[model samples]
Target chain A: MVPKLWNETIEEHRRAVREAVLETTAALVAEQGLRGVTMSRIAEESGIGRATLYKYFPDVETIMVAWHERQIAGHLAELSELRDRPGTPGERLEAVLERYALIQQQRHGHAGELSALMHSGDHVTHAEQHLRHFVRELLTEGVQTGEVRDDVSPEELAGYCLHALAGAASLPSRAAVRRLVAVTLAGLRPQG
Target chain B: MVPKLWNETIEEHRRAVREAVLETTAALVAEQGLRGVTMSRIAEESGIGRATLYKYFPDVETIMVAWHERQIAGHLAELSELRDRPGTPGERLEAVLERYALIQQQRHGHAGELSALMHSGDHVTHAEQHLRHFVRELLTEGVQTGEVRDDVSPEELAGYCLHALAGAASLPSRAAVRRLVAVTLAGLRPQG
Candidate 1:
């Protein structure tokens, strides 16, 4: 068996290589569209051998999927942190929705093709499920505090927030996105 | 120039052929999905000769675009008629939103591929503009009657309603679609 120190160093090197690969591919995709990217180009740009790149990711499509997974994970973590932070349930919900809208706004024109490719598969479904649950929990908490409407179930309300916020993709400005989030939140307010 | 009788006959025939082509192509797309459709199949199914079909549309894509245009026109007309019917402005708005939500609900799994193909063109842009204006007008009238919240602009509220109702596309039942419309309308109500 390898020594403990040797094993730790190897694992760290592997993680570093994976991170470099994901970041390099994302930058290449940004510079050139998805169609313009290739595995060999990624290998060259990342200063890794083509054979080694293949070992890490078999193709450009796989690399894109990995990058998208990383992006989704990061966004979820950010929302989760915001939800856990000190704030009223209403405030937390607003912060999470704003972040989500901004994320959608930033994605406009940045990855239309990439999104079409990445939106399929299990990862996306799982991520959507996780997101829905996260938002539902926040709304549920708000309802308990009398900050959210009781007429709608938290599950349905979660769907409303998500679908409304998705409109941010076509919005021309961050201010428009914020307005959208505000309107959505108003929909969640307790009925008078 | 042709005589009046001859001209009228030719115009009627042209319209009938155009309608048949659009309907046939839509049916083919529904039955076999977008990829499986073809110009020859459309011509054969519509009972129009290949030469005659070519004169009407250049290819399958053009036929699909024409079909989509007709569909949008029909939907816009339906919404307009509902809006113009005898009712209070608030009731008219609810009728329009409900109809739109039902349309989205019925569209689930119906022509997703066709929608992606048809969404990018000038026709879609104009249709969206018309829709936004229609909804905005309804909200403006509602605000005049003190039925809608005045804090948000009618234009922004129009965006919210549309984006929120679009959630109907994924809802599992007509009941759920109605519920979505209710939640969206809840956002439009005057704040107490």
Candidate 2:
């Protein structure tokens, strides 16, 4: 049996190694494109041996999926915090979109690709589904509260909101994307 | 001067060559990915002479861009006809998204390595900007006519809508995307 101190050290080492994989994966994907992502390449990028990397992540797909999950988790966590804040459903939706817009602006171009790959679609793994359900719940709550328009369904609105971001994030400028979102929100609000 | 008959034949030949190249490129991209795109491979796939292929396109990038442009053109043509249809702005927006969603569904699994290569801040080409503008204009017009909400900007709404589609499209079930869109649309409409 391992000693207590050794167990702690092993756990800490595993966490560090996992983080290293994620960081390496992101950098590799950002620079060399997705094909640049290989077990040996990631191992080299992370300064870990191939065997060690495999010990950490069984394959490239696993790492890719996990890396996506982490990025998504970060956004979902932040959005959930925003969701509970005091405001009407409209205000909350606005806040969420605003936050998304700001964060998206900083992502250069991968925001759409990454977001698209993660969208609440059929390929969604469990965590992606969680994000989908969370957003849906947020919209449904808005409708339930009567702060959001009743004529439109939350799923349809959520789909639009997501696609809007993916396409907007791919735009050349934040200004361009912002203008697009402004018009869409104007359309989504209750007509006078 | 070239004979009129020869000129017509030349034009027809050029069109055929372009189509062959496009088919080759699409198949290659679908097979080996963007990295796998090469002039020789395209020539091989399309059964065209290398010299003839070069006469039409100078480089791989140019060929791919041209091919993508053609794809955009088809979608744009569809949009133009839809715009002429008699409908409210809201109806038009819904109709347009429905068409887009259908197209997206078909291409759902096609985006992978090629997309990852272009998912950068500086990756927006002029054609992509033009497409975004086209969609944004549709949203803007919808808002201007008071058929859509005035709260959100067209750019933002477009951004949101695109994001929603990309995100939701990632799901395993295409039907889920449809449901999501329907729900979101209901949420977008005005309350009684």
- Cα RMSD to native, each candidate? 3.4, 5.2
DockQ of 2: 0.30
Give Cα-based local distance difference scores for all models. Answer: 0.83, 0.68
| Candidate 2, lDDT over the whole model | 0.68
TM-score of chain B of each: 0.90, 0.83
Candidate 2 positional error at B75, Å = 2.2
Q: What is the TM-score of each candidate against the true structure?
A: 0.84, 0.71
Model 1 C-alpha lDDT per residue in residues A100-176, reported as the tens digit of each score? 99998887653645664565222354666788999999999999999999987899899999988877877888888
Clash statistics: count for each candidate: 0, 77
Question: Scored by Cα lDDT, where does model 1 land?
Answer: 0.83
Give a tens-digit lDDT track for model 1, residues B113-133: 575446532236467678899
lDDT of 2 by residue, A123-190 (tens): 47676567557766777877787665556567666655655554544466766766655544554654
Model 2 residue A163 distance off true place after TM-score fit, in angstroms: 2.4
